[model samples]
Target: MKGKNKHNKLKPIMKKSMLAALSLGIALPVAGSLPHALAGAIEPTINISRPVLNDDIYWLSHSSEQVDALPIMPSMPIGVDNNTIIIDLSTHFSSDRFTQLGAISENTNVARAYVTNDNKLVVVPYRSGKINIQLQAKNALSPEGEMIRDNIELYISKKGDLNGDDKVDSADAVQLYNYLRNMVTRRGFSYVEKNQADVDRNGEPELADMNALLSGYANQSLGAKDNSYVLTFKQVDDAPYALNGKLNGDLKVGATLTSNIEFFDPDGDTPRSMLYQWYRGSEASGEGKTEIIGATEAVYKITAAEQEKYLFLQVTPQSYSSDRPQGNPVVLRSESTVAVKQEDIVSLSPSNGSTEVKTNAPLVITYNRPVKINMNSFSSIIIRNLTSNQIEANYIFFLGNNFRANDNKVIIDNPGLKYGANYSIEVSNDAIIAADPDDNAYMQGTVVEQNGVQWTFTTQIPQ
Candidate 1:
C-alpha cells in the first residue's frame, strides 16, 4: 500500500515538469525576436537642421576679403541607441566609399571645405565659383550610414560694394570716399566688405581705390558699356607723346604768346599736371635755345631781351602714378621771328597850341606802348610861362605829390599857370624810355611825337 502512494506522487511531478518545458520553448523564441525588432526601431539617423540639407547653397565672397570659416552645418543632431556618433568629410572618404559621398568638384581653386570637430562642415571661399561639399554621419550601431550632401555655389565679386547690395553704383563710391576720409563714424567694414572696397585690387582700401570706384560710377551714369566697378590693373606703362604742337599769339615785344599742344598717351593715362617752359632761340628752327628765367607758365610775355629771337614752348605731361610719372617733352617753335616795337607818343590830353589857357590845367602825355620814366631827366621836364619868361612848374618838384606815371601814360600837376598867358611845355629826349629797348627801337629815350607835337596844351581861361 506504501509503494502505491509513492508512485502517485512521482506521476504528478512528471506531468508538472513537461508543462514547464513547453512554456520555456515558446518564451525563448519570442524573447530572441524582441531584440531584432528593437534593433530595427532604434536605427541611427543624421538630422541636419541648418542650411537645409540637400539644397544648393549659394555663397558670394569678395575676392579682396578673406573668408576665415563659414559653418556649413551649424546644428547636426544624431539619433542612435546610445551609440558613438562619427562625422566624416567627403574629401577624407576612401576610394571605395567615394561614390557614396556624391559628386564633388576636383577643382578647389575657388574655395575649400572641411569638417569641424563638432561634426559641423565649414567652407572657406577664396574667390568666385561653384563648389561641392559632402558630409556623412555614422554611428557604432550603423557603420555604413547615409551621407548628407549639398552643393555650394560660390560667386566671387570684385571689391567696392561698400553697402553690399551686390550692384556697384554711385552710392558705393560715396560711401568709400567718406570712409577713407573719416567723414563718417568708425563703422568699419567686415572682412568681406573690405574686400569689396578695394576696387583697385591692390590689397588695400586706399584713396586710389576710391578714385577708381568714383570713375566707374561716373562711367556707369554716362551709359558706358565697359563700366565695371573693378579696375583692371595696367600691366605695362606707355609714355605719353605729343600728337601735334603749335605756338600761337603775336611774336613781338610786350605781346603775349600761347601754346596749343595736344598730347596722346598710349595707355590712356590722364596727366595730373602739365609743365610748360619758354625758350628763346636765334633761329625759328629752335637752334641755340636758352631757357627764359621764371617763364614756367602756359602763356609767356615777350620781353625786350627776347626781341629779334625765336620764341618756343616746351610742354611735359606729368602723372601721379609711380609707374610712369613723366612723359616725353614736346617742343613747339613759333612760326615767325619776334620783333621789337618803337615807342611813340599816342596822344596828348590838350591841343598842341591853343588860346584861353586856364590857371590850373595839368599837363598829360600818353605813349603808344609801355614806357619807363627816366629819373635822371626829372629836371629837364618843365612848364615855362612865355609871357613872364619864367618857369611855371618843374616836374622834379611834383614827382610824388602830383606826378603819376604808368604803363602808357603820365600826368603832371600844374603849379598855377598864368590865365590867358602863353605857355610852352618842353620835354627832354631822355625823360621817357621804352620798357623794352632794342638796338633799332626806343634807343635811350627816343620818343616819337604824335600829330607832329610832343606835348603842348591850352585850357579854358578863367571859366
Candidate 2:
C-alpha cells in the first residue's frame, strides 16, 4: 500500500486540479507534482541538437560502387555537420518513454527522413533539391495524447563533391576526370554522380564539366564562396571553302574529264555531300558558260556535241553541320578548248584526176583540222602503176625517205614517173590515219576513188 497508496492518492486530486485550472483559464504545472512514472507519459519537447534548427543542412548526392550504399555519406571530421541529427528530449521524458518517435519529409521524391531505433534522425538524399523534415514525438500527456514537433531544412546539392569527402577539391576533380575518360574501373556514372560531376549544370558530364570543377576547386581554395565559380560555353561553327580545283582530263570530245577539287573547313567538319556541274564555254576563261545537260557527277564524258567548246567544272561543297551549309562554288576551266573528234581530208594536191602532172611537185593531202599522223602506220602507204600493171612504189620504198607530215598535211616526195604513163596511186583505207591534236581521237582515211576509178593521173609526155 505504501508504493501503490502514494500514486493512488494523487491520481484523482491531480485530475481535479488540472480540470479546475483549465476552467479558470490558469495553467497548472501538473508534471512537477505527478509521480515519475506518470510524468514520463507526458509528451516531450522534440529538439534537433546536432544541426541547428535555423541552419540548413548540406549533403553529397554521389553514388559509388565501391561504397556500401548509394548516395554515400561524406566522411566529416568530428565537429562538421552531417546528415545525421541527434534527437534530444525534455527532462520529463527519456528516449524509450515516448509512445512514438518519427520523422517525415515534405518532399519525399527529393529526400527522405527516418528516425533510427536510438533516436537519431537520418536524411537520405536522392538528388539535388531542398526538403523540409518534421521530427515528432508523441506520448499520453492527455486523453488524446500530445505531439511535440520541430523542423529542419536539408539542402541536397551536387556541388562537385564526387569523392564523398564533403569538399570540392583537387581529389574530386581527378576522380571526376577519370570517370569521364573511362579511366576508372567502373566506367559508368550513376544518376547522382552524374549530377555531382556536371558542375556547369548542363544535364550531362563532359570535359567542360571537369574543367569547370577544376576552376571551382581553385576558386574555393582562394577563399571564394561555395558555388561561386560559373562557366559558360558557345558552339563554334565555320563554313567550308575550296582550296584548289581543276579539270584533270584532256579537253577534247570523246574523252573523260574528272573534277579534281579539294575542300577544307575551318571548323574541322567534312563535306557531307558535293554537287558537280560541267559547263561548256567558248573560251578557257570560264565566261559564257552553260551547264551541260545531265552532267552532274564528279566525272563527265565529252560528247560529239561539245566539240570545239571549252569545258569547265564547278564544284559546290555542302555540309549538314556547318553554319553555312553550302560553300562558295569553285569554277575551273580546262586548259584548252575541245578539239575535233576526227580529222577529215579537205583537199588533194594536183587534183583527183589531173591530166598534166609536174614531175617535181610533191603529192600532198590536207585535212580540215590539225591532226597527228601515226608515224607507226606510215608503212601502209602504197603507189601502183595501173597502166604498166606493176608496183610503182611500196611502203618500204618511202619509209623515211619520202614521207613528211606538216601541221595539217601529209606530203610525199614526188616519185619518178615515165612519160605518157597512165599511173594510179593507191592508198589503203588505213594507210593515212588522221588523229585529233588534243585527245588523239583517230579515223582511218577513206579510199580515194574518182568515178569508180582509183586516183589515176596521166604524166606529161617527155619533152
Candidate maximizing TM-score: 1
State each model's C-alpha RMSD to the native: 31.9, 30.1
Q: Rate the local accuracy (lDDT) of all candidates.
A: 0.48, 0.52
Q: Model 1, stretches more than 4 Å misplaced?
A: 1-234, 347-463
Ten residues in sequence with the least summed lDDT for candidate 1: 1-10
- What's the lDDT for residue 388 in model 2? 83
2-60 per-residue lDDT for model 2 (tens digits): 00000001011222332332333222223223111110111121111121111111121
lDDT of 1 by residue, 357-390 (tens): 5666557778876776655554455787777788
Model 2, poorest ten-residue lDDT window? 1-10
Model 2, position 437, has a per-residue lDDT of: 40
